[model samples]
Target chain A: MKNNILIAALLFAAFPLLSNTLVVCPDCPVNTIAKGIALANPCDTVLVQSGTYYENNIEINKDLTLIGEGMPVVDGKEQGEIFTVENKYFYIEGFRIQNVGRSYVEDRAGIRIRKSTQFTIRNNEFDEAFFAIYLQNSSKGLIEGNHISAHSLEEANSGNAIHAWYCSYLEIANNVVKGNRDGIYLEFVDNSLIHNNLSQDNIRYGLHFMFSDDDSYYDNEFVDNGAGVAVMYSKNIVMQRNVFRDNWGAASYGLLLKDIFDSEIFHNRFNQNTVGIFMETSNRLKIQQNEFSENGWAVKMSGGNQTNILSKNNFLHNTFNLSVHSAGTDNVFSSNYWSDYAGYDLDKDGVGDVPHRPMKLFSYVVSSTPEAMVLLRSLFIDLLNFSEKVSPIFTPENVIDETPLMTPLPVFGKV
Target chain B: MFKIFKYSFFDLIRSRWTYIYAGFYFLFTLGMLMLSSDLSKVVISSMNVVLILCPLIATMFGVMYYYNSREFTELLLSQPIKRTSIFTGQFLGLATSLSVSLLVGAGIPFLMFGVFGSDQAGNFLVLLFNGVVLSFIFAAISFFIALKNEDKIKGFGLAILVWLLLAVVYDGLLLLGLSWFRDYPLEKASLIASVLNPIDLSRVMLLLKLDISALMSLTGAVYRKFLGSGVGMAISVAVLLIWTIIPTLGIRRVCLRRDF
Candidate 1:
């Protein structure tokens, strides 16, 4: 039976890349995948046609492109990691791979490319594979246009869709990642371009990056994920023109910038997330021209990080413009259009005459105790906010926009 | 004791219907494993499915195995043998065969997943293994129901109902209680549920082993905080053994007192 072959093939990964197209029909040639790889040559492409191909622990150690023809179904049958690719200049596209065994220690995946350079994985679909397109200790890779969905249902059950670990010069774009713990994740990936991806409906963040430095991302859409994008402990990153929307939860954010330094966050659209941007211990960041709309909390500053500029932005329809746990020092909030700002323009200038203190006391309470969300729409919340604004007690005193702009914005650019 | 164990084991194996039930059970398990997506939930949910199957298989086989082997048992009783040994052999045999079939049917597929270090893997193994344990437990319980309850059909009904109550209903009522008292530090409520039912303990043990202790929320926290991993593992194994022993001992007591 096909199940027997699948069970047997799980220990190996070679599904054969011969002549760029491989067909794995029932009683077809080569039920055991690694065996077929011995006959395969470099620069050759393997086409896995529409059937269940059982690949038993085949290591691709040559230059080849593996493409699945006619939506071939590759079942690892819950045995182990299905495909292990170690080839440079390898391109794998268009296969439905499922039931790859989950392992935390192994960092397993449907298609795991380790120490591989300049590989392109596109148009492939993964179902419940722990890490769909996992690049570990690999450099100069392109993981694009892959559709990956894993059902975790429990935290221990799922892994990231696209996980890049210790990989540099990676281009992860145009991928649709969903259902896994995190979609399109990069850990210790350096100098990469992550853009134009649709990552959503995941258990955790749509896109998460940590210890990844000098990476620039723009024009990607993150929607309906548990949390939005999280950039942590990385330096000199550029995040521009991305649409962060519909991530609504108690602990969710449009973008979470934590322990990061010297990152440029510009022209990003943060909508309907719990908090637009949560910055904790991030310093020297240039925050410019971003649009924050319909979010629960626009911005929350927990640590007293310094020298981060917030200017030329639009904050509209968020319940609270900002929440600060500490008197976060040396962060500028100037010339930003706040929709909640009722201050007048006395000199007929575009700028407001009166300075606006954005943070409210209720936000402070909510920051301290999450249970205070039940008191959100009450008069007590309003009274506390008004009292704090009148005298500045609960929130950060120095965190205020000196020149709150009167007009909405010149033109909110596409992000 | 050894003689009785031998006699029971053969009796259950000889019952042709037991083999048929086991075959069908294996097929059903395979069908579910292939068809279901969101495999983790499918695993936990299948516990109830196993519950329904285990008791039915156990009770029917247990009742028929004991009833049909009455003549053979009487023949052994006429020989140089103690009544307790005859009873023990029957109990041991039925429980052993049921456990073996359950393991063969479901346990190997789960292990074949090779998903070590995942909560899903641990959860699934426990779930399927619990089926094996429950088979033995329920088989022993059925012996008492068949002998002491007078009517064979009534004993079968009660056995089925008791299995349902233990496997499913108790947890439902406990959840309702936890949900009702939300803000009352109900984190410890999970431990309460575990202590109340051993299946819940098995489920929790599997989840905890997966290294995903964070998302378990209110009750899981209590378990992690109070009962350490060692304690949890010990408790799970103990519960399974307890489930097996209680009915076997109960059946022996019933058998000793009953006059044929």
Candidate 2:
């Protein structure tokens, strides 16, 4: 036992010799981040101190830990990509990077990880980077607590904040992203988790998903984005405890689902958006325990969505509760609390006696002739809506909440 | 000028039409609020009414007041008051009373609904501001028309015609122009046309503030940049101010030269 202990102690003491801590400073022999990485061995840590390093096209080819002390400024000088990692077990934290050149030919980024596994990127700030953190074929990664911002005046020249392609088993949490083309974009990124993030004021959708499957996002706040969040051509996704607010634009929505299949969206708040949730050609979705308030149109389902269940949700003070373009939609809406429902609960149950019809005739008219929307609040339109409620004609008859709650359901998620 | 303004304001306030107008607004706003049970919807409904009715009422009232008070003004001209002061005083008095009626009438219901404690207070304030500006602009234009035309029938007819041209015809012409120039970049042209008409300008301003979701859907970077930033708001407000000032100055100019 003593011999074994001595051997273990020797191995533990010798491990430090194998992995070195290389310091990079202006006055030191290793001044630049690239130089430090070039001299570093596998399992070595490269420490970068506080200074402005005007360099780009840095390549990290080994499994190394890069820690920045005092928040070093890595100015790409509008040159190119700052960091390109190709090896596994890479960890980077605490750096301020800026000014990566905009290129239409190449997808330049502040940090790009290629086919790397077991990587972590945290506590970094990126400004003016075309693509802040670009992950391609990366698995088992954690991208946490990063702040990315860009002033993208046009979409053709700008890139996304966090662009993930063909990535799996990734966790992106507690990051703030603003003013990019898309805040966080995922393409074919499956089995990932995104949570606790604030994405706002982007030039395009705050969070965009395309052909990504089995992903879950929770506790994320998206506000004032150009087109809000979009989930497209995906399946088996979960969205919960998120806040979509103030995404007010002519073609904007709090959440847009296109060609999506078999998703669950619950406990989300949609507030003051142009359209809270817009679904087109989506199927088999479950939407429950959500709060929709003060939006222009709460949910606009078109393109013949099928088999979606909407229940236990609160529709509070929305201009139009539901706008279903197609007359033969097979979606189910029951046990939901609609603030505009005028039916009474004479039986003393919590449900209204008469089933509440949410789709209005005027909304249908507005869909057909958009210019008629200017007469939205006019007495003529109000009279028309009232008469339609008395006898349904234009609005779809199937889109009714049979078990409508008399009072608003308790709001889901955090206020 | 102050004494003239004070008496004219008091005299108009005591008139039956002011109370009737205020009562109409009061009952309508309160009834809408009670029926809709939503502050924002009520505001929107009231905005539609204000946009169409304020200009019509202002035009008719301005013509009628100027014609009815012609003998009074002649008597005042014989008094020691300056001609400009007398005319300016009456204009200010008419505009101020109309604005007050609008404010008190709409303000009572909005405040009763606890709007001050709500998030839509800013939108409500903008609505009221648009109403006041519309009243001032249309009233000034009508006063100018009345000042230039000595015949009462001609003055009244021309005033209503001006209102019709602005409130309805201008939009029709604008839509026609937009469709005609559909192949060109007509965003700037449409925006300029809206700005030239005070009624359309105020409508767009209030719509931009209240119903932005609908407007933001418009296709064009210029519209987005203008409406999404404070620059658009400033420009709209500035143009509305110019609209108000220029017409009032026109009234002053004609009164100075006219032998009435």
Candidate 3:
């Protein structure tokens, strides 16, 4: 009788020490997710079963693990933000959140993380979210394997997917963001790694950066967006092994770098964009080993870009290879392969004997007067380009590839 | 008219120059098909060649056939056929023969490469249609020029000069005009200017069908709004028809009033 009483006392003492899992279902006592989270302890797990829960403003304010079983639908019913996480050490996985309402005043998101750190938002599906996976002043977050999509009509009325502001050390990988205003927007963010994300068909830029520095994005694809990727007012950016394709429009480009300094863009494939890479006031960029094919303009540099090196790149079949409006000094174009290079190498070297001038007279004229594009493929323009190419007259004389490769470089193997 | 058309068509088809033109196209198209694996790329490359070569060859053939067959044409003029019918039949014969040579020559290689089974079938059809229409338009214009001038050197010179004006000088002047009116909206003006010339018209039409229209739309929203709609296509087709009709009417008017 004494031993039995002591065992009961021990069992009673160990009960609160163990972490409890509260299951939330339609027929359960704890029906709603909010109730389950409310009744759980700080480190407890809230397991939500498969059902459509029409709820909004599900606030999470403690260290908790929210796991959805069989991918439960958390429908916001177009009300407002769905999951507002404001605490640290939180984890959410495998929930289908949808229909956070559009508001002109507030940026409604499916999952809004405010002042949170060390959070993992993984494998969630979001549909019609105004701004999906919004993180403000958050750090050390892992946002992986999320499918965020929205049917954004215009830039004014829509918001971005995976918007991170004032965040650092973010690992945003394996996310498919489509049809949003801007997929993967980062403003005032630093030291983040974004990889293997397919951001396409967004109304605005696929991946956008403003005042973000020391970010490296690789193996990401930006396809058919409004303008592909735009990195503006940033420094020390490393972009490698990304693809920018089919982002075609009046003011579209594969990559737009404005006021960006000390960036490296290498091993990227830019195909079928209006302008492959448009640099404005960007300096000290090392662009190398890229394959630019079938773009309208491969690289269009304008406005005081200095000390940029474009070497060992392959430019094939673009309408206009390079168009430099005001040519910057020390902008080197060396050892690149140009498909339009007609110079031969009599000495049996791989490099051509004559230097190649990629800027055409017609492109120069069209730059000054865009209306002249109506005569794009005219014989007169071809004659003028040929005449100008034979002798450097209108184009900047400093912009020339001295050692153009005779054959195209093998850029596909690295990718 | 049918007899005259048959006679002229058979006579031209029997000539060595017709065979040579057809053979040239066949060899060139086959070479392009063999060289490039991409159908759309081949279509674009062939568009460049067709845009330049179709009008030039049609113009040359029209003037050369008129000059070479002067004796036979004079013999036919003595017959009891209506003047409009004779000239119209001759014009149709020349245009049809040229189109046939283009069709059989370029079409054979495209068919061999399975263009009909490819996604570029629509673009290929547009290309051939542009080629045929260009042949008819240029042939009618050159025939009109040839009939107006009795001097062989003057007629050939005038025909060649007309080709140069439409093919080269018109674009230069258009460029100059566009640059001069840089601050103003020139999309409509440029569209009108291009439609005025059949070569530029055909080139624009083919460009719209190709992927390069993306680049062209960068000029202005007016270009995008106009060329991105069915109304633009209808207007282009109507203008092409007008281009074909007005010159053929000129040919008929000159044939009737002139003293053969």
B146: Cα error in model 1, Å: 75
Stretches of model 3 off by over 4 angstroms after superposition: A1-16, A413-415, B218-220, B227-231
lDDT of 1 by residue, A263-334 (tens): 999998888777789899999999889999867778878776789999988998677788877774888889
True contacts kept of 1: 0.00
Give per-residue CA lDDT, model 3, range A105-199, as digits (tens): 99999998988879999999999999998999999999999999899999999989999999999999999999999999999999999999999
DockQ of candidate 1 is 0.01
The fnat score for candidate 2 comes to 0.22
In the order shown, the chain A TM-scores of the predictions are 0.89, 0.98, 0.96
In candidate 2, what are the lDDT values of residues B72-155, reduced to their tens digit?
999999998788899888988998899899999988988999999987798899889989999998889999999999999999
lDDT of 2 by residue, A1-415 (tens): 9999999999999999999999999889999889999999899999999988999999998999999999999999998999999987899999999999899999999999999989999999999999999999999999999999999988999999999999999999999999999999999999999999999999899999999999999999999998679999999999999999999877789999999999999999999999999999999999999999989899989776999999999999888999888877789999999998999999988999999999888788666545444434544456678999999988988989999999887767553
- TM per candidate, chain B: 0.79, 0.95, 0.96
Off by over 4 Å in 2: A1-5, B1-12, B15-45, B48-100, B107-205, B211-216, B219-260
Query: Which is the winner by DockQ between candidate 2 and candidate 3?
Result: 3
TM-score of chain A of 2: 0.98
What candidate 1 gets wrong by more than 4 Å, as runs, is A1-33, A368-373, A391-394, A410-415, B1-260
- Candidate 1, Cα interface RMSD: 13.0
- Cα lDDT tens digits, model 3, B50-119, are 8888899999999988888889888888988898888888888999999999998899999999999999
Residue B248, model 3, lDDT: 94
- Ranking the candidates on DockQ from highest down gives 3, 2, 1
